[model samples]
Target chain A: MSGPDDMQGDMPEMTPDEILALDLALGALPREERRAAQLRLRSDPAFRALVEGFEADLSPLDATTDPVLPPRSVWEGILAETAPQPVRTAAPVSAPKPSLWNSLALWRGLGFAGTAAAAIALVTAAPQRQPLAPAEVATATPEAPPQMLAASLAGADGTPLLSATWDPLRGTVVITPAAKPEAEAAGTTPELWVIEGDKPPRSLGTIDISGPNAHAISSQRIAGLQPGSTLAISIEPMGGSPTGLPTGPVVATGKLSAI
Target chain B: MHGPVVRAPASPGAAELVQLLGRAADGDAAAFRDFYDRTSAKLFGIILRILPDRGEAEDVLQEVYVTIWRKAAEFDSTRASPVTWAATIARNRSIDRLRARASRPAAPLETAHDVADAAPMADALIDTMRGAASVHAALAALEPRQAAAIRSCYFEGLTYEALAEREGVPVGTLKSWVRRGILRMRAAMAEAGATA
Candidate 1:
């Protein structure tokens, strides 16, 4: 029987550069060179794509090994670690504070006192928080409140350009100008877009670099604010992208993920 | 041009995995559990290959899933399939652990001994995953020695020097085989439309 290796006679030879790329992909390079190649991947798109291609090419090798079932407790441990920590509330009080260390009411009162102090301190520190009507503030949920997503958007070069956080409950996307190359920030306003799987990019709103970076867009307006979507920032005109689509070079991109 | 290649056996459940990852990213606990059940075994196997110690491998596997939980929103299906994306994470994490442990000198001998007796059986290496048949076909195309070098380097996270020493070949010869083997395998996989 003609074995599979027989077909290798016709296989084309790989160039030295191709071999080096393959070596880098296999993690077979010497220590110093491997580190150099990995650093290059961060700043070089062509190099990154080449490495990624090797990853994709060799991924099938993973299938050859049988899956070994992990212990069930591992899953439990993951859940325990990843589960959102509930904000600790003050313990219940059976009676009024009794100046006794063991009394539940004293401890509960102390907890409330500390919480109130921290809230006061935070409110004092952040003067930018717009004061809400007491009536509107009272409508906030009593239970575990909805959390927002904050992502640090990076460019293809892996440099942080803008820090963004979208609060679904509050209907706001907060953008903070970060360490971006000067050329990227010059001559254009930064516009944000949300891209879901295979869907057209939708504009969330323009980010005001001079003013508060927070832009108010309801969750109803942006469909892909959830996970599996990407939050990309592109340079645009003062009013935003005139064509309603990202027209300029994408300076930074980050996928919308849980904080 | 290497365009997109369809992964045959595209069941709704497979597609649901991507959606489930999305929900898990939203901190939906149930969806996260389902994602773990579907994926953890394969990830565990990948980690175990590098770490050798079951306990350490399990620990790394746990970290991998947690990273997935935090970064599932970053799982762009357009960029990579779920298994490939996850395997990359597992491999990278395992490599990181391996590097951290490299300072200690107790590992090489034990790992070399294991490699001596641990040639995987042909049948044991086969699986029903969609790309397995194609990959196996391409790997089968290599010379047996070339294939072993590739497998040992990949599965065990062996460096060229380690693999060369273990196989009792000059480092240069082994490098030649590995590079040539990889090129042939890539060609065959591309022909099979299995290259990413």
Candidate 2:
């Protein structure tokens, strides 16, 4: 619908080759033109050479760019999203369409059931202590934001597999796995790791992949909760990684950004 | 655009980068991690400049690597260096995101000062390839408006129409400027290489 707004006033007539080269460089060509160029890239040596030359000329713009470090969670998210170890879920006759694992509603819709109830009970039964907000009574803090900084651990397909939240006030890390990962065959337990800056992940504790599990994080360990730290879930052997590192594929992971 | 020199981990040279990419193509997680570590920051910067939102840039950066993971094997070093190939992908994806948002009234352009400005890599890195210096020299030789058109088009991934709109110039003038700018830079860079 929107043509390059029909170039106005006294345009010099250009050769088709020059226009094609410029169009490729700017990616301004319509879809059909782009497809034709791509076909030319494969089939027409002269055209390919022309395109590559333009790419070379323009590439310095890329080379001189300032480098900005992305948040640690980005790489972790990439790993969790792309790490394609075979998922042990029962292979269905037809594969289910890929779902958005990042949706909190999807997890909530799955009926966290008793695990959800237990999470509330644990939050309540545990000392109603507010380490930082001493002025306000802990009893009044809402269920979500104030008490917990959560990471939704998803499978390779972005299916929400586990939810790990760091409850700073309670000094505990709560992990609620949505459903049993069939990967739990033969005594393998899901281990949690705190992935921090360029450091080898440190084990938070082992968690049951089939149910809700909580680990009391010592004050010394809570220091890792600095923004950008991640809670990574990996399927490890019965006793967890023998070397105190993540020995298995990181199945699910989420970042621990401060609220 | 000049700023304080910030030294970074020198780019992994072309050969090693290609090797890492090939390994990643074969589904080697460790190799992919190494590839990501070396390039993500640079790629993030490019995307951030175009998008100007940290969260959106991060999301797009993640998408770039996932695309890289799937398509690493398709990288033909004979045609382009690893950085060029990957940066092209990043640029294209960022543009796609920009175009998708064009229909709606987008947020005001965040000025360069407003974006979290990281110190630029020092000249040593910039000059590692003689081609880069020549390219910069070439850009410097252009008329100021022509050079700005080229940079804004390449860096922001703006189409001729969008750039024309932003500059309040006729699309024909903007296109001519950009086309002439590219041709001029090509000659200047080739000459610089000849001297080298």
C-alpha lDDT of all candidate models, in order: 0.60, 0.61
Candidate 1 residue A253 C-alpha distance from true site, Å: 13
Model 1 segments more than 4 A misplaced? A1-21, A30-32, A86-259, B1-9, B103-128, B194-196
Give one clash count per candidate, in the order shown. Answer: 0, 0
lDDT per residue (tens digit) for residues A70-143 in model 2: 88999987876677654636767356424333321222212111100001101111234456664565555454
Pairs that collide in candidate 2 are none
How high is the TM-score of chain B in model 1? 0.80
Interface RMSD, every prediction, one decimal place: 13.1, 12.9
**Clash-forming residue pairs, model 1:** none
lDDT score of residue A87 within candidate 1: 36
Best by TM-score: 1
